[model samples]
Target: MRRKSVVDTLREIRLLSELDDGEIAVVEKNCRWKTYGASEQIIDQHSDSNDIFFVVSGRVRVVNYSLLGREITFDDLEPGGHFGELAAIDGLPRSASVMALEEARIASLPSDQFQRMILSHPKIALKLMKHLAYLVRTSTLRIMDLSTLGANNRVHADLLSLARKVTKDDMTAVIQPIPVHSDVASRVSTTRETVARVMSDLARKGIVERQKDALVVKDLERLEDMVEDVRGE
Candidate 1:
């Protein structure tokens, strides 16, 4: 595979989308790029490195371990997504550890450069604020689900959220690279066994089917209704 040039990789980053070619050239000069193998640690939770990172290719998961060493996943970021800005903004340690879910290419801008960019670029600043707002909102929802919903319903919400991200049609959706039950369990704070059972039940009900490389949601409406019924929506 051809290694992407600095400009090419910068072009793939959503956070830098608003930059003009000249602006990107400036950024290109200031940023550092690296690639990691699958499962490689990109950033350690509570570490002091404050460079903001952007995904140029592949995927990464933001996560933290509980006191008992149980992993709690915060989110996954694919190509075009960015992370680590919170640390840059607040001048604090990383809030979560980040690991590459697959072999991934990433770009990093030093905290000082990132802060300067935000101060100089109003659009970038606005985008950052909006993205942070979204993070807070989703975190609130997750907290609510954990506090009020049962394990099964939390699983439902997790699947529903995933399904919405890659909906195929009005009646169907396909989650490519079918989710790992253990990962779902971690995300929803349920046991792996519970996630397996819930998924098996979903399969038996014909609401979801496992394909060669994906999980197909056969009855998207029905699944939505199931989630809504519990949420009283």
Candidate 2:
């Protein structure tokens, strides 16, 4: 693959799209670029560094580990997504660690430069504010689920969430390259065994099917009802 130029990579980020060609060039010139191998740690939770990073290639996961050594996954960023802006804006330590899910290229702008850019571009600053608001809303919902839902219900909710994201037509949804059971467990803050058991029951009920490389939700409505029943929604 041809390595993308820093300017081209910056242009790929939606957050920076408001900048014109010349402005993107300026931003690119100030960026520090690096690459990480699969599963490599990109940032440590509570680290003092506050540089904002853009995903130029590949994917990464935003995560943190509990004192008991269990992983909690917050979100995954594919090409064009960015992270670390909260620390940049607040001048605080990182709230979560990030790890590369695959070999990835990342370009970072120091906090000072990031601050200057956003302050100078009102549109960029407004977009960032909106983005942070979305993050807060999502965190609130996840916290509510953790506090109120049982492990089984959380797992069902997680599956339903994924199914909705990729649902096709009215009856079926396919999570291609089926998610790893352990990974799903981490997202829902449950044990791998629980996830596996829930999946097995769903499969037996013909609500879901396992293909050679994907998990097919055969009855999306049934899965939604399962989650709604627990939530009383």
Which candidate has the top score in lDDT? 2
lDDT of 1 by residue, 1-233 (tens): 65563334587678778999899888878888898999999999968899999988889999999999988899999899999998989998789999999998888999999999989999999989999999999999888888888999999888998999888676888998899988998899888999999999999999999999999999989899988988876
Each prediction's TM-score versus the true structure: 0.93, 0.95
TM-score of 1: 0.93
1-233 in candidate 2: lDDT tens per residue? 66454334588898999999999989888998898999998898967899999998889999989999999999999998999998988898899999999999899999999999999999999999999999999899889899999998999899988988898786899998897999999999999999999999999999999999999999998998999887877
- How close to the true structure is residue 108 of candidate 1, measured as C-alpha lDDT? 90
C-alpha lDDT of all candidate models, in order: 0.90, 0.91
TM-score between model 2 and native: 0.95
lDDT of 2 at 9: 57
Residue pairs with colliding backbones in model 1 are: none
